[model samples]
Target chain A: MSTEHPEEGRVVRFPTGGVSGEVDIGQLFDAHAAYLVRVCIRLTGSRAAAEDIVQEVFVTAHRRRGDLIPDSNLRTWLYRVAVNLVRHHHRSSGRFNRFVDRYKVDPREAPAGPDVDVERVERAHLVRDCVAELSEKQREVFVLYELEGISGQEISEVLGIKLNTVWSRLRLARKAFRVEWQRRHGEGDHP
Target chain B: MSGPRRLMDDPDFRWETDCDLGDEAILHEGLELGALKERVLAAIEAPPVPPEPTSTASTLGASGAAVKGALGVGLAVVAALGVGYMLGAAQPLSSEGVAEPEAVIEQVVSVPDARLPVAAPRVPAVSAPEAHSTEVVEPVASPQPLHRAPAAVEGGASEPVRPAAAAEVAAVVMPVQSEAPGTAEAPVGESGTVVAEVAAPGGVDAVDGSRLDVEMEVYDTAVQAMASGDYAGAVPAFRSYLRQFPGGHLSTEAELSLLECLFEAGSFAEAEAQASRLLQAPGFGGRERELSLVRAESLILLDRCSEALAIVDALGERDSRTAAVRRECKRRR
Candidate 1:
């Protein structure tokens, strides 16, 4: 059985036992699935692919359940798994930008609703394209920090980089992203 | 979450916090998180599909059950651990705060030992290109110029890119491994497509390493042929892949690509037969949509509008490609 945490439903705890007597995956999914999905969507540039990759992350976690010792930062662990998978997805698909173009839901065909503004959706796509232009190091750090709201120390943990390196890469990523954003949106604007 | 570290002041980069359309909010909207969770759980609980035998595709009698039982045991052990983690021993780390003692992350999670080779890592399989339509248009240029004051804002999206190739009846599809350590190859394909580079994944046992090398070589040959628009050349190479690695992890993908080659080469009847045969094969559950669509298109090309319509209708009416196929079939009828 699972119940959401009292505050904001951010954490979900499970009462059942696992094979290795480690953390319950149901609880993990309830807690981190949304965050991982959002990060993956930015990483892969496709909702369907992001969903698929996140599912694989859980499955991989399950397969390696023995690794889930006490005090293991499962969130960071899961993010690591996700980063590897996203890298594989990008490497396997080749020219990930093209893959994004192929899989990106057309704003014109975006789900119809009162809240779904085509211009906003298009701008979002533009933003994703800019992020994709960053070097892989910068992109991962930038997405984790700026988009996902993960702190620098945690981003360092997830990426296995020094805290200083994380900030340094982020600084570079922001600069590169702005340059690319300018190129796409035209010279006068700074994103 | 820990308070963010010291900020650099740049007013132009405040996309993360700018209106309701900040980076996080835009990315977060439209995702069905609950439904996605349900799907993840369902997939986790589902039975593992047994691989087809090397000797023959149809002989799943006793051996299949043995394989299934082994896989079941493996999964059962993991599930028990998962439950154990939940019920008693290892409580999941609470998402209470972002800043944890550095020791916890370091002591617990070492990078996983198994990894792909860093130089020229090959994905074990390739998906059928026909699964996605190539009907892409150029990105609309950004409208008004926003100012660039350097205060903190939000994140953005991927890099802008033009569609890699024009729409074609038989678009060539292939994976490009990042350059190996010694190669001096150009990054662009002959057709002007940009091939992005990536680091490699190394470290495997000798036998597995050699086997993967051969597999990648064979797969690469077929992909190269396909990329060069030599469907005739690609067809035989793909067939060779099936013959060489019957029960290989990527066998189904090879089979699918083979069918697509035939379809692209205008051999509609042959492709349709292959598609139907694979569609009925065991352990191909998730691929029904792609296989059926390709099969339906082949039937339509063969002037069998009724049969095509039946397949298309079975796929529901929501998918744009399926809908397009239905419209085309009905018009032809």
Candidate 2:
């Protein structure tokens, strides 16, 4: 028999032998909710959407308690599930075009901390604009390597691409970025 | 030596110190790169907590309650079967003991509601199979009918049914199949009962429609900016997404992308700030070591060479990448 005590907290007592007693759902929520929200936010770029996804992740987790992986990799498993949910969400929305149009501006130029210098910030924005014009494969490779600082191996794992492909894409992305930078800044007569 | 290696080894083609691009340009690129890394690390490191189950349960209402009751009943049945088997094994031998078994059966049968207190809400006049089809058979008793009253009372305002109400409706509409003999042996039966209880209308369309594609597109756009050396543009694209979805699934990737953009654009301060945020996030356990390396690079761009060297030294113990970068930084110093 399980009982809730206001002072002692909720406790679950198994009758001799059972499925290891009931778990505290609240504690589980406290530990994992924020992470799930963060993942959704990253994938969707909207707090509202992230919140909705977080709710779904919990509801599904509750439904499949028995299928939970052991403690060591529970977070990893949750992330994997969250990733799957985000993928599903993307497929169902069919609004990739609209999203692209809406958020096409340079991110670095956006208003941020007051401590930032206006001139330096503008230059940063210019560079970001340049990178945003690259081919998708090159961009992904550059972001994973130079931006995310992920190893080629990790990038391969995340993007599901070949190792050599990552290197090639990175080389092309770097060369292209340099060329574009020179064009924007004007040639110095050397090249 | 290979052509590429020869070029790399040439004093004129120095990959270190002698920047044909100039110090200002290199510093600008370094700062943006740092900022982009920070964003990615933040996304990767943020925790993944799920929402509260009680709230969902409440919105589910009577249906949720019915499912809980059915689960309780199932548990009770399992317990009863175990007890029955134990009693059978412990019974004394002989013809006279047969009467004792009958008395025991009568005693056990009389305690009907002992195992399930919630089962008493609905009387067992209907046969178990008939009870199972209660919602289908007795459409008038549908929980939806009851929900209409509350929906009207709450102001006919198109407000979604609360989870608790939903649970209640589920309980009222689900068929009571517990009366069937030997049905407890088939565990799959319980699943059907649960499904019938919680099958509330319009429950599955809560997920968002446009968010995922927007994020992917934003990410792609940011990458393009980086490739074209429009570090300024990439920074805002990444930051915009981060602002909209701080806890986004791709925020780590965005953050990293933004960091790189910032670094390349010469926004060292912002790049450092983003990196610090990433390091602070708990979700970055696996990636922190690498992020720290980026942070060090950011520090170096800001002319904080000693601090950058320290970060590189720390990373040197565990990450070869940082160690190599650290050696390069040392040579530059």
Candidate 3:
């Protein structure tokens, strides 16, 4: 079973047989809950929605815990669950939430960095807006690879798509992100 | 042979390089995992109730009246069957012992788009006469609904019965349905031209009611503005339409119109991106040729002729528009 952090610095250690081992739900939450929350936050662009989705993800995992196999990758499984929940949220809520949430970064919750400035926040907003511009499929791959730093192979597993398909979507996502970035920030900026 | 680019393989191309900040710092914005673990575990122990169904209908033009009690019962019955079939046919989600991973992946990835609202029920049970019921079902029955006769009627009576005219027709018929429902039911001439003259607008009203009409109005206003050469106004109008009626049948028209506005306004790069995004969307069909041409033209203007030619070659259409685009791409190359 693969044990990797979807976000940086947070490390997870899964038993060899995936979540089927002696590890309980709390252990799984301890390891991957933060990372999943982070991914969901970006996927949803809303903390409350992300929290709701991730909570549902764990609940689903609990419901289907019996389905877990020793050889199955728990991280990929969890990611799939989170992505599915996020997609469901998108459908039920429609595009308005995402559009409104694009600029809804809470001023009370600024960046973690000590030197956070207005320009940095603006750039972050621009990047998030550009990322949000991607199609659902592209956004899935883009968020996993670019923002979450997940490997292509692991992303393929998580998304249940072929590696080639993952790469193709990533390419399109990157191109779309770059174009959106240019459109929002400036016409000629490569970012 | 080279494969697609990976971020790890090329440091220069990463998003972090774009803005000198870590992705986690920007995205997470200092949101921590502490205290949330207990909330997650607690929630897992006591699963929360699912949220109440929102008023949002998955299919475009399906009115609140349609979903309230009118079409909801029939749609729910059909949707139940569809869900049953989907569940039975879906591969077991367990990663192990799966014979066809690709099939499983396709099923999982395609789940959201194939929800309850899009259950394809061709039930011809509209309030209209028997002759016109088929017109209502004909558009909604297809997985990709197109505005056909309604669009033509909206543009002008003289306009030909083509799928392209449906956008305008949807616009015109919408207000009629809202203001005066009886006028929509009035008899008009010709069977084949029913959707254009009488049945199409009436059909939409009878089946979907004001919800579909409102959507059509939004889309039509944008298309009208765009047609009148107000590209700037049209762009926002189309964007609003898309935001309101995303993934609806009318969305295809809205997206295409948005692309047109962007391209006409000399925003070729943005147009290309929008075209690419739309082209990749699920259920994106019926307008592939048109969208492809727009993308190719946008790429050509952006000086990406090789990509444009590749698209042109794939289309394999020798029409004048394609021919002109091809010549322009070759000259630029």
Candidate 4:
């Protein structure tokens, strides 16, 4: 029998002879799924592919239950796996642009309500487009640093690049992105 | 520049900052950044399904049962096992020996000259004029003696005579190898014998030559040039690689890299041609699609929106990379 714990909503299960074992796959999924989807979407720039990748990550984890590290951070592990899968996917396809093109969603039509911030939405789209224009390495670094807000060390771990390389890529990405924004908006406009 | 430096010199740069974009714009940017982060995080997390117990139980049960069954069978079949093992071991070797020559011949036909090792006997397989197209293998039976002639005809010989010599070799050897037992003697022609003798030395030298490593080295050099924004320097390296290893395993990569080089060098037409060649190849299944997308983007950059959109439309939404590139192409259009 499985019962929910009040604090974390974790499932507690009791079996024969007072022996107890519990697995909280639901909680794990809820906490991590959204974040995983977002990372994949940003990397691939396709919501559908992101959804597919996220489903694959969970499926893979479910298959290798026994190999799960006892003390390891599951979220971080999942992210690492997702990153690797994306890299493998890119290598096999040899067509990053095509993958992005096939799965990208058009920006939703702007709503008419007063609360619907058109400028913000437009800015978001512009940023996404600008980021997409970056070199693969630059975009990765920018997403990890500015968007995900991950520390340089964590980005290094996720990307498997050296810490120095991560910093360099981040610097270059930021500079290039800023330059792009400036060019698009013209001389007087600054962000 | 001095004013900007002075602004940076302020001790409380963050607190004292006064950007041209107003507070609302800054807040909006922050919100946008947050939303993007949330999306990214959501993409990385795993799914909600609990691991299935049925698969694990079945696998374990089957393996356990197999071990027990094997132990019981071992006790009953101890007398006959030795003969069975001997036959099993010898079967693979016999089959492998029979298959070796055909494998070598196929390899000679498929791989490019630059990728072939120095020790590889040059069998004149049919060379397609266009590097990426399929080679037309002549029939193995009607040994056309004329095809065996050297690629370069003697000075006085007409262009017609050269093709005749090539045709003779193709006709003679193709039939002999096709009909005879796999281990039959090498064909009598000079090129055929050379290739056959090369196959006889176990063909380890060809594998050991490390063609991929050489290509990788050249690729790395070209990438370095691109990284430094020296598009002109990158062009020659990529072109050299493509020329040398036309049908090399990394040919797709070289083709794509060459397109990038040409684009960066502002040779838009050349880049388009390379991209067109890539799309024409049948094996450009996966990452090759991305090459086409990039090529389209280059076209967009060149203000060739109609052509770019056409390329985008051709790439149906099978993959995200293509979809993203398509979106960009459409936007530009």
Top-down lDDT ranking: 3, 1, 4, 2
Interface RMSD of each: 11.5, 23.8, 13.8, 15.9
**Candidate 4 lDDT over residue span B1-333, tens digit each:** 111121123344324322121211222221123343333334323243332221212322443343233222221121111111111111111111111222222221122111111101111212223223222233222222211112211111001010111212221111112222223122222112111111211111223333233333444444444444555665665554444334442343444445655754667677777667656654343224445665675676566767777776775322333443454566655
Q: How high is the lDDT of residue A1 in model 2?
A: 23
lDDT of 2 by residue, A18-119 (tens): 234444444445556665664454345444445544554544444445444333234444444454444434322212213223424513314456665665
Candidate 4 C-alpha error for residue A182, in Å: 1.2
TM-score of each: 0.44, 0.27, 0.47, 0.40
TM-score of chain B of 2: 0.36
Tens-digit lDDT track of model 2 for B232-262: 6656555544443343333444555565456
Shift in Å, residue B48, candidate 2: 17
Best by lDDT: 3
| Best DockQ among the predictions, by candidate number | 3
| B237-320 per-residue lDDT for model 3 (tens digits) | 666555443433345445555665676566779888987876766433323555676687678777788998899788652333
* lDDT (Cα, 0-100) at B148 in candidate 1: 16
For model 3 chain A, where is the 10-residue window of minimal lDDT? A5-14
Candidate 3 — what's its lDDT? 0.52
Instruction: Show what share of the native A-B interface contacts model 4 retains.
Output: 0.01
lDDT of all predictions: 0.49, 0.39, 0.52, 0.42
